[model samples]
Target: MTTIEIDHTSRWFGNVVAVNDVSMTVGPGVTGLLGPNGAGKSTLINMMAGFLAPSTGKVTLDGKQIWRNEAVYRAIGIVPEREGMYDFLTGREFVVANAELHGLDAAAAGRALATVEMEYAQDRKIATYSKGMRQRVKMASALVHDPSVLLLDEPFNGMDPRQRMQLMELLRRMGAEGRTVLFSSHILEEVEQLASHIEVVVAGRHAASGDFRRIRRLMTDRPHRYTVRSSDDRALAAALIADPSTAGIEVDTTEGALLIQAVDFGRFTALLPQVARAHGIRLLTVSPSDESLESVFSYLVAA
Candidate 1:
């Protein structure tokens, strides 16, 4: 399996730094690149695909320099995020052209289309295809060369639910085959479902990298803020504040709820219900106020 390494890599555009000093290794597996829009994910992927050079440090594939290296393309397949494909060409024609460019034949193109389950619509013009169909055709074109490393950017952007699941299954199978599959997406659920490993980027910086569940647990282990509404807010808050799990509590009169900060996630979750029941208070709502991925990532960056 081929491994892509970004060692102290940084890319800039004059005064604007797109990718900050980042170092990571992408090995064989389904790895998700998680970041917000304009977080320099595309820039990083460009450097990996040998389309853009880093301003500092190195991007290497199996110890070979990726920047200014055309030979690396033999082992790399890229599915770009933009929609600037050749619209006039049929899907089959498009894939065939890509195969030819890679010194491959029509059989390779046919196998790729079949792998993406797009052979049924391969004869149709790309202009007449739906967004998901176009995505599959693009995937077929990328896979025509049978590269070991596959890089996809926002691959599920316009796919329907079924289409999205189909593509996810395909990626899973590819990862199982030990192909180094790295995909960039801003959607948390997409990464959570498909990626065994994830790298998070925020504002051009590497925020976190690990198994999603482990990273999620790390995020949750921090101070947790919750909003709770109960039949007796004052009584509930009083009882909870006495517990060691709770660090602070405030009664928000405007919202008729208690804002609580808990230092221990597991202890607080178990303690809250028990405390409310003991005081004969019925809990109306118990919700984490800072459980969103964005909030979790922000907390991580702050730490």
Candidate 2:
């Protein structure tokens, strides 16, 4: 099986460091490059795609160096997040152009378009296509070479529900066939449903790497912050503060809510309603304040 190895790699743009010293192995199977926006995911993907060179260490395909290597293109295919395309060309023409670059013909392009379910709209100009359609056509262009390794950066960004599922199934099948597939995504649910393994980056740092469930557990176990509104905010805060599960609670006078920090997630969740009932305080609104993927990633980085 094909494997991509990143060894202590780092990339810098003048004074700004994009990717920090990070090392990870992407073997045959679907691996998710997970992180919020501006977490160096695109920088890492560009390095892996041989479009950018690492400033410090190495990025290799199997045993060969990927940077400035022309031969690696035969084994690698990339679906970039950027929307640059031949606007005047039809979908079929765009894919065929990519195919010809690999010394292939229209037959290969036709098969790729079919694989991405874009044959019906192949005659339409790319400028006339929707964002989702353009994304699929770019995927077709990438697949036209039938490479053993596929690298997709935010592949589901513009896809609708059905298009998302179709691409997920295609990646899964490719991985099942022992082709190395790596796609970057910020959405937790997308990664949870599509990737067999996940590599998480935060603030240009490699924060975690493992199965989705394991990563999910880490996120779940972290200290969670929540906002709670009750009929008696002060009374609810006083009761919740007495519990060991709650790390801290601050009554926000402006919002008329209690900002709670729970160190023990399970215990705090179980104790909240019980405490509210015992104190005769009616809970009105309970919501997690830091539920964004960005916050989750930040928590992992802190851990």
Candidate 3:
């Protein structure tokens, strides 16, 4: 099985460091690179794809260095996040061109298009396709060479629900076949649905690495912040503060809402409605303020 290893790796753009001293091993099966924007995920992926060299340490595929190695491209396929594809070409022509670059033929291009379920629109110009169609065509081009390792950077950018599910199934099957599949995503739900193993990066540092459930528990166990609005704000806050689940409560006079921090997510969620009803406070709005992946990454970094 193909494996990519990053050992004590760091990438810097002159004075700015994009990736810090981080290390990880990506083997067979699907692994999700979980990180917020500008968290060095793209930089790390670039090094693995041999598009960018690490400033320090090494990034290798198997036992060979990946930097400046053109031979490694035979074993690695990359679906970049950016939309730099040729809009003038049809889907079939674009995939055929990618196959040709790898010394492949029309048969290889056809198989790749079929794998991504893009054959129906293969004759259509890329400019005429939707966002989801464009993504599928990009995926087809990457799979044209049938590489052992696949690296997808934000592969589900603008896909609809159906298209997203289709891609997930394709990746799942690829992983089951023992190909090393690594996809970077900031969306928790996307990663949770696709990858059981995840590596989290925060502020250019490796924050956590393990099973998704374990890391998810770590994130959820922390105090959750929420913005709560009710008819009787003072009464609701007072009632919620008295509960053991609530750690703190702040009255936001400017927003006319209560900022609450809950220690026990499950207990607090159940307690909120009960307390509001007891105090005869009509709940107007109750929304999580720190549910974003950035917030979760920040908590991991602080820990």
Candidate 4:
């Protein structure tokens, strides 16, 4: 099985650091590169795909250097996030071109197109294809050489539910065949549903790695922030502050709510209702204020 190793890799463009000191090993399996947009997921993927060189450190495939090495292309297949395609070319023609680059023929391209289920519309111009269809064609091009390592950046960006399902199943089969498959995605549910292991990136830093369930537990255990609006805001705030679970509470006059920081999730959840009932405070609105993926990633990075 093929394996890609990123050893303390860092990539910077001028003054901006795109990928910080990040190190991770991608082996033969489905691995999800989970991160929010602009968190350097694409930069790291480009390095793995041998499209970009790291400013520091190295990216390797099976201990062999990947950058500027043409030989690695035989084992590496990439479906980039960019939309740079030959619009006039038909799906088959495009995949055939990719095959020719690897000393392959039309037969290989046909097989690739068939694998992606794009043979039905193989004769159509790429300009007429939907985003999902384009993604599948790009995937076909990547598979034309029958690569051992596949790197996809946001492969499900424009795919519908059915298209997503089909692609997921295809990737699962490839991983089962012992292919090293790594796909970047910002959606948590998408990653959870597809990958056996996940590597998380937050602001160009490697935050967490390993089983999705354990990483999810770390995310859940992080301090939670909430906005609570009640009939008796002052009384509720006073009651909540007396408990060790409530770290702090700030009265937001503009929003007519109390912004709360809860340290112990379980304790705070159980205490809230009891405190509210005791104070005769009817809870009008109780909403988690920092439930975004970015917030969760930031917490993980800090931890």
* Best-fitting candidate, scored by TM-score: 3
Q: Per-residue CA lDDT of candidate 1, range 1-303, in tens?
A: 899999999999999999999999999989999988888899999999999999999999999999888899999999999998999999999999999999999999999999999999999999999999999999999999999999999999989999999999999999999999999998888998999999989889999999999876776789999999999999998899888999999999999999999999999999998998889999999999988767777887887
TM-scores, each model vs. reference: 0.90, 0.91, 0.94, 0.87
**Consecutive 10-residue window with the lowest summed lDDT within model 2:** 158-167
lDDT of each: 0.94, 0.93, 0.94, 0.95
Count of backbone collisions in candidate 4: 0
Model 4 Cα lDDT, one tens digit per residue, 1-303: 899999999999999999999999999999999999999999999999888999999999999999999999999999989988898999989999999999999999999999999999999999999999999999999999999999999999989999999999999999999999999999999999999999999899998999999987788778899999999899999999999999999999998999999988889999999999987889999999999988888888888
Worst 10 residues of 1 by lDDT: 291-300
Q: Residue 207, candidate 1: how far off, in angstroms?
A: 2.2
lDDT by residue (tens digit), candidate 2, 239-263: 8888899999998999899999999
The best-first sequence of candidates by TM-score reads 3, 2, 1, 4
Instruction: Please tell me which predicted candidate would have the highest lDDT against the true structure.
Output: 4
Model 3 scores a C-alpha lDDT of 0.94
Residue 94 in candidate 2, Cα distance off native in Å: 1.1
Candidate 1: list runs displaced more than 4 Å.
242-245, 266-287
Candidate 2 lands at a TM-score of 0.91
Model 4: ten consecutive residues of lowest lDDT: 214-223
